[model samples]
Target: MGKVTGFLEFQRLQEAAEAPANRLKHYKEFVLHLTDDQARQQGARCMDCGIPFCNTACPVNNIIPDWNDLVYRQDWSRALDVLHSTNNFPEFTGRVCPAPCEAACTLNINDAPVGIKSIEHAIIDKGWQEGWVKPQVPRIKTGKSVAVVGSGPSGLACAQQLARAGHAVTVFEKSDRIGGLLRYGIPDFKMEKSHIDRRVSQMELEGVAFRTSTFVGSAEDAALFGQGLSTVTPAQLEAEFDAVVIAGGSEAPRDLNIPGRELQGVHFAMDFLRQQNKVVAGDKLPGQTTAAGKKVVVIGGGDTGSDCVGTSNRQGAKSVVQFELMPQPPEVENRELTWPYWPARLRTSSSHEEGCDRDWGVTTKSFKGKNGKLTALECARVEWVRDEATGQMKMNEIEGSVFDVPADLVFFAMGFVSPVQKVLDAFGVERDGRGNARANTDDYRTNRDKVFAAGDMRRGQSLVVWAIREGRQCAASVDAWLMGSTTLPR
Candidate 1:
C-alpha cells in the first residue's frame, strides 16, 4: 500500500461524460478523462488490505495493488508494465468493463471504492502517449505454425501470446477486416476502431499474421447454417496449421419467436449495430435502414439495448422506448448485505440520459404490421409471484394490462444464445447443454486432439476481459501441449 490512510482522504472520482445535448449530435467518444493529479490521487486510494480481492475479481487478474502503489509513487513506466502483464488490452477493458473489481474492493465495505477502471484508463492512455507500448518480439522462433480462427479479443489475445512464445501464428477472420466483433458488432462511439488498428499493427510486428475474409468451414457447412461467408474447408486448416484454436464468438442471437417475426423493419440488434459500425468506417450501404423519423422500440434492457437507444437517438428517431421483461430493480442496493459483491440494482446508462422511455415487467406478445412493415407491438405488463406448490417464482400476465405501442422499427437485443454451430460442426466438437463449445476451463481443449476453443465460443457470451483471460490461458495450454513445457503465464 502506498498510503495507509489514502482511502480516508480521497473520494472516488470517475470520468466525466459529455453533455447529453452536445453528445447526441455525433458518434464519438464523449468521456472526459481525469487529470494526472486526480488520477494519482484516485490510485492512492487503494487500501492496504492484506488480501487484494480486486485482483481476483478482475478476469485477467491485473496486479491492482502493485500498479496502485506505482501510481501513488508517480512511477508511470513500471505501472504500465504491471498493467500489461495481465491485460494485453487495458484500453478496451478500461473503457467497457463493468469494473466488478470495484465491487469486490475491500474499501467498498463502507466508503466508496477506488476508481480502479479510471486509473487503468489513465495508465494505458499515458503508456500510449509516452510511447511505452511497443512490440515484444520473441527472442527465438519455435518453428511451429498455429491457426487462430476469429480475430476478436480472444483470438487476437491468443494469437499474440502464441506468436510471442516463438510460434508462427496466423489469425483468420471471416469479415473484410480483422477484429471479429470488436470491428463490427460494437458501435464506434463506445470504442473507436483505432484502438484495434494499433493493436493489430503491434501484433504484426510480433510476427502474427492475419487473413481476412477467410472462413474455416465447407460450403455445405456454411449453407447448412446460412452463415453468409466464403468457406475454407476444415481439412485445409488441419493440413496447413500444426494446431488450431477456435476463438469464433457466440454469434447465435436469441430470437423472438412470436408472430410477425418475419415482418420488415424488425431486426436483430447486432445486424443494426454492425451496419452502423460499418457506416462509421466509411463503408456505404445502398439500402441501409435508418431509425430517422421512426418511432423505435427496443426490447431487452441490457447493454445492447442501451446501445440501440443511443444509436436510434443519434439516427434521429421520432421516439425511443426500451422494454425489460423482469421487474424494475431498486435504484440503490442494500450495501450492508451486498457489500464487496456485485449487487443487482437499477442501472441507468448514458444512453438512458439522452432520452428514452423505459418500461419493466413487460413482455412482447406479437408484432402488428401492414404491407410487410412493422407498425406496432402488442405487449403486456406481468407480475412475478411465488407458486404455492412448487415454491418457485412464475410470471403471470395481468389480463387488463395488455396494450399496443406504436413501433415503426423494433430491435431485439435479447442477448446471444450460443456460438454458431457451423464451425463447431466442421471440427466435430461436442457442445454443452447450453450449446456452448464444451471444453474444460483448465485446458480449453476440445474432443479433437489438435483442436482447442476459447472465448465466447467455448464459454457463453461474456465480457471482453473474460475473453482475453480465456485466450491467454488457452495459449499457455496450447504451448505446453506443443513444446512439452510452457513458461507462459496464465
Candidate 2:
C-alpha cells in the first residue's frame, strides 16, 4: 500500500458539480473530473482489507487496491493500465454507473468509502490527454471474421476485443449512429456523444468495421426501430462471418396498459428521450415531444425516470412530479448488516437534486383526459402485503385514498421488458423464460450454431459496466470457438 495510514488521514472527496441554475441551461456534463492531487488523496483512502470487496462488487472486477496504490504513488501510467485491464470503458461507468463497489467497500462499515469511481475517471481522462489510449493493432491476422450486432457498449467492447485479437469484426447498428442506447436512451447532459465517437475512431484504427444504419436482421425486424437505413438478413451474416454475436439491447418497454394509455400526451419515456437527442444533433423532428411549459408526470422511480426529470427541467417544464409504486427505501442502509454487498436504500440523483416532487407507495389508477388528450392522472395510495396462502406480495388500494394530479404530459419510464422480438426471431435464437437470449456466462453461446449472445441482449437491460464485462467475456468465447484457443482476457 502507498500509505499505510491513508484511510485515517484522508477524507472521501467527491467530484464537484456545476450549480443547478447554471447547468440546467444546457445539455452538457456538469460534474467536473478530479484534479491529480485530489484524485491522489481520494486514492489514498483505500484500506488494506484482506479481500477487496469492491473488486467483487464491481461487475467488471476492477483491480481497485492496486490502481488506488498506483495513483497514490503518482504511477499514473500503471494505474491507467490497471483500470483498463478489467473495464474497457471506465469513463462511461464513472459517469453513469451507481457505484455498488463503494457500497461493498470495507471502509464503508463505519466511515466513508474511498472515492474509487472518481479516481477511475481521473486515470482514464489523464490517459486520453497523454495519448496513451491508442489502437492495439495485432501483429498477426487470425483470418477469422466476426459479426457483432448492436453498437452499444457491449457490441463495441466485443468488436474492439475481437479486432485486437486479429479477427475481422464488423459491428451492425440499426440506429443512424453507432452507439445503441448510449447514443439515444441516455441524455447528452450525462455524457456527451463525443466520448462514443472518440472510441469509435480508435476501434476503426484497431481494424474493427462499423456498419451504421445497417440492421443485421430481416427488413421487418429493421422496421421495428425505424426502417434501418440498410438491411442484412441473418442468413447473410451467418454465411459471411465465422461467428455471430447478438449484442442488441433489450428494447421492448413495459407499457402502462391502463385506461387512456392511448391518449395524445401519454408516451413512452424512450420516445421522448430519443427525440430530444436527435434535436440536439441538429435533426428536425416534426411534432417533436417537448416538456416545455407543461406539467410533466413521470411514472417509474428508476434512472430512466430521473433522466426524464432532468430533461423536463432543461426543457422549461412548468412542474415535474415522479411516481413510484414501491415504498420508499431508507435514507441510509445499515452498513453492519449489509456490508460487502449492495444495500437497499434511497438514492437521489443529480436530476432529483435539481428539481422533482417524488412520491412513493403510489399507483396510477387511470388517466383522465379530454378528447383523447391526456389532462390528468388519477392516482391512489396502495399498500403491499404478503398473501398467507400464496406467500407472494400483492398490492391493495387503500379506501378513500384516490387523488388526481395535473398532467399535461405523461412519460412512462417503468422499464424495458425484453429485446425487440423480431430480431431474435430472425436469428432463430431461443429465449430464456425472462425473454432475454438464452446463453450462459461460461460460454455466451446461443442455441443456434455459430451464434452467441451477450450484454443486455442476453442478460436483459443492465448497467453499462456489466455490458462491458459480458462483451469482453463473449469475445474470448468467440475467439476460442473460432481458433480452438484464445489468450484474450475476459
Candidate 3:
C-alpha cells in the first residue's frame, strides 16, 4: 500500500470537470486528469489493508495496492506497468468505469475510499504524455492466424494480447471505422475517439490488422446488419484462419413494446446515440436524430439513459425527463451489511447534474402521438410488492395515478438482451438459455471447434472491465490450445 497512516490524513478527490454550462456547448471530454501532486496525495490515501478486497472486486483483478504504492513513491513508469499488466486500456476504464473497486475499499467501510479511479486516470494520462505507452511488438511470429469478430473492447483486448503472444490477429469491424461501440455508442463528452485511434495505431505496430465496414455474416443476413456493410461469410473466416473469437457486443436492446412503439419520433437509445456519435466523428447523416428543441422523455434509468440525458441536454432539448421502473434506492448504503459488495443506492451522474427530471417506479402505459409522430407519453405510478410464494418483488400499477408527460421525442434505454443472432447464426454456434453464445468462462469456447466467444456475446450485457477480463482469459485459453502450454496471464 502507500503510507502507513495515510487513510487518516487525506480525503477522496474527484477529477475536476468543466462546468456544466460550458461543457454542454460541445461534445468533448470535460473531466481533467488529476495533477501530479493531487494524484500523489490520492495514492497515499490507499490503506495497507492486509486482505485487499479491491482486487477481487475489480473484474481484471488489478493489483491496486502495488500501483497505489508505486504512484505514491513517484515511480510513474512502474505504476504504468502495473496498470497495463492487468488492464489493456486504462484510459477507457479510467474514464467510463463505475469504479466498484473503490466501493469495496477497506477505508470505505468508514470514511470515503481512496481516489483509486482518479489516480489510475492520472497514471495513464501521464504515461501517454511522457511517451511511455508504446507498441510491444513480439520478437517472433507463431505463424498461426486468428480472426476476431467485432472491434469492441473485448475484441480489441483479445487481439492485442494474442498479437503480443506472437500470433497473427485480424479484427473485423462492421462499422465504417474501428472501436465498435467505443467509436459510436459512448458520447465523445465522456471519452474522445482519439484515445481509441492511438491505441489502434499502437496495435497496428504490434502486428494486429484491422478491417472495417466488414460484416461477418451471410448474404441472407446482409440486409439485417446495415446498409453499406460488406458481407463476409462465416465459412470464409473458418477457412482463412486457424481460430476465431466472437467479441461483439449485446446489440439486441431490450425494447419497450408499448401501445404506440411505432411512433415516428420514438427510437431505441442506441440508434439515437450512434447517429450523434457518427455526426461528431464528422460523418454526414441525413435526417440525423437529435434532441434539439424537443421535450425528450427517456425510458429506463441505466447508463444508457444517463447518456441520453447528457446528449439531449447538450443538443439543447426543451426539457428532459427520465423514468425508471425500479423504485428509488437509499441515498447512502449500510456499509456494515453491504461492505465489499455493490450495494443498491442512488447514483447520480454528471449528466443528471447538468439538467434532468428523474422519476422512479413509473411505468409508461402507451405512447401518445399525432400524425404518427410522438407528442406525449401516458404513464402510471407503480409499487413493488413482495409475492407471497415466490418471495420476489412484483410491480403493481397504482390505480388513479395515471399521468401524461408531454414529449416530442422518446428513447428506450432498457439495456440489451443479448448479442445479435445473425453473427452467431452465421458461425453456426450454439447459444445458451439466455440466447448468449454457449461458452463457459473456463475455456471461453463455444460448441463449435476452433471458435471462442467472450464479452457480451458470451456473457450477455456486462461491464467493460468484465469484457476486458474475459478477453484476456480467452486469449490465454487460445494460446494454451495452440501451444501445449502458454505464458499469457489469465
Clashes of each: 0, 0, 0
User: Model 2 over residues 446-483: C-alpha lDDT tens digits?
Assistant: 99999999999999999898999999999999999999
Q: Is candidate 1 or candidate 3 better by TM-score?
A: 3
Candidate 3 all-Cα RMSD: 0.8
TM-score each candidate: 0.97, 0.99, 0.99
Which runs in model 1 stand beyond 4 Å of their true positions?
220-230, 388-391
Model 2 spans with C-alpha error above 4 angstroms: none
**10 residues in a row with least lDDT, candidate 2:** 220-229
* Minimal lDDT window, size 10, model 1: 220-229
Model 1: per-residue Cα lDDT over 209-251, one tens digit each? 9988777887765565335667777788889888999999889
All predictions: root-mean-square deviation over Cα? 1.5, 1.0, 0.8
lDDT of each: 0.91, 0.92, 0.93
User: How far out, in Å, is residue 343 in model 3?
Assistant: 1.0
